[model samples]
Target: MIEGALGDLRNGVSRIAHNEKIEELQSEFSGDKPHLQHSKPLHLDPMFYEALDVLHYVEPTCLAAFLKLSQFMHRVEDVPNTKAYMESDRIIKWPPNRW
Candidate 1:
């Protein structure tokens, strides 16, 4: 459980026997943002909160859903526009550090 961030993977999980490659980082989330502007900020983009939500509760409703969602998430990372999406403030950028 990435605290449910990738819970879908668990659901879609199977005894089907297959092969896939997943890139798990040494840490669940990475990157460091340290700057003077970090002065106890009072506000953050709504997308930021949405990002956290996906990170918090993305478990699968079923095992099929889990496998499907995992492939979907993996595919999302493979899209040509992924770099752009990650840089932008879109829900697509959910799981900021993990993705």
Candidate 2:
């Protein structure tokens, strides 16, 4: 899980850095502002999608680990059954909730 998190982090950072360079070049070569040149819906942005994908994977793992750790440390009386919850039919929306 940690490795998956790290991989996602690395991929997100790498994509952002590459896109930043692309934006810089676009701005230098165009009269319009970089943001204007890249005009698209927020949902269409690669970075935004990548972040959502990363959070989708990482959040559940972290939550499960934390719950297990809390149980091990006697911080909580009982850890909820994460496996069952994950297996259930559920639709979890992310940033809209975060926002």
TM-score of each: 0.25, 0.27
For 7-38, candidate 1 gives per-residue lDDT tens digits of 55443332121213221220112113221123
Candidate 2's displacement at residue 73, Å, is 42
Tens digit of per-residue lDDT, candidate 2, span 15-76: 64445344344336433522222532232233343343444455534323333222322211
Worst 10 residues of 2 by lDDT: 70-79
RMSD (Å) per prediction: 15.0, 15.8
Candidate 1: global Cα-lDDT?
0.35
